[model samples]
Target: MKKILVVDDEFDLLTTWRLVLQLEGYTVVTAANGVQALSLARADPPDLIVTDWMMPKMDGVALCRALAADDRLMRIPVVLSSAAERTPPIEHPLVEFHRKPLSIDSFVEIVARLIGPA
Candidate 1:
């Protein structure tokens, strides 16, 4: 099973993503903020990460940069989901950016493509 880490400050969004990804048969791990997300990733890296840009502590852009700088975690694919007007520069080749308020099908398709075969 593919492992996914979802990072967002909102509790409801975190729970919703966990449940949605779990239902899709992916092993889901969640973090309420970028700091916790980075900690979890260092402890046990997920195959893919879905993060919100406006998170407290580190925020998604900083988190992405940090992960990209780390050789061990740089290879992991990252998908940024946000409603922000500005998009962060994808420092790593494996990173992808997407807008928020995503439809269920679009989310599933992106997740499936990144993680592969659910």
Candidate 2:
């Protein structure tokens, strides 16, 4: 099973994502903020990451940049989720962007594409 790390500050969204991804047969891990996300990633890196843009203690852009900078974690694909009009500069080769209020179909498609069928 593919492992996925979901980082979002909103508790509801975090639970929703965890349930959705679990139902999709993915091994889902969640973090309520970027700091926790980074720590989790360092301890046990996932195959893919799905994160919200505006988070406390370390926004998604910073988290993405940090992950991208680290050679050990740079290869993990990232899907940045944001509701802002202006997207953050997470222009790493392995990162992709997803606008907020994402439909289930689109979300599933992107996740599948990134993690390869789960």
Candidate 3:
């Protein structure tokens, strides 16, 4: 099974995402912020990461940069989501950005496209 790491500061949304991804057949792990997510990734890297743009103790962009700096984590696909006015541009091939208020089907499709079926 593919492993996915989902990072979000909001507890409710995090839980909902975890459940939905798990239901889709992926082994899911979660982190409250980029710091936790980074540690989790270092210890046991996930095949894919889904992160919120605005988070405490390190944002999604910072996390992506950190991951890019590390060869082990750089290959992992990342999906960045934000509700802000504009999404930041990422040059990495494995990184994708999407706006917030995503429908489950759309989100799942992106995930599947990135790392194959959950």
Candidate 4:
């Protein structure tokens, strides 16, 4: 099973994503902030990461940068979501951005595309 690390500040969204992804047959792990996600990744890297842009500690961009800096975790694909209308200015090769008001169908498609159907 493909493992996905999901990071979000909001408890409801975090639980929603985790449950949704798990039901889709992906092994989903969650973190409330980027710092926790980064630490978890270092200990046990996941196939992909779904993260919210505006987190309390170490935002998504910082998490991406930290991942980029680390050889072991740098190759993991990242799907970054934000409430901002425009895409953020992140240029990492393994990173992609998604605007908020994201639909479940689109979100599933994105994940499947990145790491294949679970």
* RMSD of candidate 2 to true structure, Å: 1.0
Q: For model 4, what is the C-alpha lDDT against the true structure?
A: 0.92
Model 4 Cα lDDT, one tens digit per residue, 1-118: 9999999999998998898899899999999999999999999999999999999979998999889889999899999999987665675679999998688889899999999989
**Model 2, which residues run further than 4 Å from truth?**
none
Model 1, stretches more than 4 Å misplaced? none
lDDT of 3 by residue, 36-70 (tens): 99999999999999999999999998899889989
Report the lDDT tens digits of candidate 2 across residue range 10-49: 9999999899999999999999888999899999999999
Q: Which of the two, 2 or 4, has more lDDT?
A: 4
Q: Report the lDDT of model 1 for residue 109.
A: 92
lDDT of 1: 0.89
Candidates' TM-scores?
0.95, 0.95, 0.95, 0.95
Count backbone overlaps in model 3.
0
| Model 3 stretches astray by more than 4 angstroms | none
Q: How large is the C-alpha RMSD of every model relative to the true structure?
A: 1.0, 1.0, 1.1, 1.1
